[model samples]
Target: MIISEGSLVLFFFNSDKKWLIRIENEKKLHTHLGIIDAGSTIGLEYGSHILTNKDKKIFLLPPNTYDFVMKSQRTTQIVYPKDYGYIAARTGLRNGSKVLEIGTGSAALSTFLASIVMPEGHVYTFDVNEDFMSIAKKNLEKSSMDPYVTQGIYDPEKIGQIRDVDLVVIDLGDPWNYLDIIYPSMKSGASVVCICPTMNQLENLATHFFHGGFIDSDCVETFIRKIEAREGKTRPSMRMIGHTTYLGFARKVLK
Candidate 1:
């Protein structure tokens, strides 16, 4: 595979050695042998081996977009890829679809959203903290989907200006306060997705979604378990990432 400059790829050796690597400008990737300048490998073909300063060979391979975002430096907890996939699927996000995302946090989900809603679509992301926004801004800039994001440092509730948006994704601590604001902005049949970690929050939000005329208020969660396989022995891994958060989705209906 031909690796793009910003594509996330893996370096491997001996058929069993692997290291997840993100391609960046002028980076010096350190290995057991020595440092390999990322600049020299930018336009190189995937699966090609590059020799380090000490002459150790390393293989290169590209990683999926999800893996790239997960490995990014995070200033805040990220929405797990499990939740992100579901959100993307249920929201019907695609090129030319406008999206509103509250509580930008580390911009992890924002980056993912931008990747799908590209070309003409734009994601209006809101965050209160400049520090978090700065980190998210840097992270998105390093990805291929940075152009689709627009940052707002104002309170989402106070702004309340999005109209006819295709989707709304809320990751704030208290999404209930913005229900009324979001309801009017969504196009008929548009979807809204919320991420909350606690059951109590879900219960409260369910009530508001129902009264606000949102249909199909469903709650879902994802659990990912990896497996270890070698020769004839294959079994579930000893550890797994579980219960990252609960996802609540609802559709807008005409009153």
Candidate 2:
């Protein structure tokens, strides 16, 4: 859409993108190419096109969850949207589904979960560090998904009580240690996903999953590659962020 005064827009590009900027009468957008009158974009729809003074074209689109999560100010490594999407889809998170997450980090995944579970579902997130939790709470408040998030500055390891939840996702160093605590709190057939960086951690967690009365425990890792498009040659980009972490998934079952 055409970005007008006060309209939020996502600039689509292979790499460079930004948010914020207001269209005002006689205002201009300064780019390396040149300056473009902001008034020229005032009435465009979402996902429209505009030309800079240098004749460079830019596409504007409505911001999605990915856009916000990737751009949110983060003190810790934020979960990528690819992994976040997998967790949300596999866990069947939607309105009315109660989800729990540990190690809120920057609350990137928590924000995604909150978006899908809105108007009914709720997201309860625990972080041991109050500083991180406070930052996450502020981040959530600025996003559209804030209503579904309940942030708690408590250590999940020491949490003595938890309600039945539809999904439990752990993003901490020792998720396996909490399986015992998480298992009983999960509703029957509820899904659990864990994010770990090492094979040893995944292997060790698998053993805990079986012993903890969980089934179908599996591990997965996602790799993403982007392609560059130009006039003559279109090929995969050389650099990629490979092996962020491995994901382990399991389901709670009646013993």
TM-score of each: 0.85, 0.83
- For model 2, the local distance difference test gives 0.80
Clashes by residue pair, model 1: none
Q: Each model's number of backbone clashes? A: 0, 7
lDDT of 2 at 129: 78
Q: Name the Cα RMSD for model 2.
A: 3.2
Instruction: Name the 10 consecutive residues with the lowest summed lDDT in model 2.
Output: 13-22
Q: What is the C-alpha lDDT of each candidate?
A: 0.81, 0.80
Model 1, position 32, has a per-residue lDDT of: 72
Model 2 residue runs over 4 Å out of place are 1-6, 20-44, 49-55, 155-161, 229-232
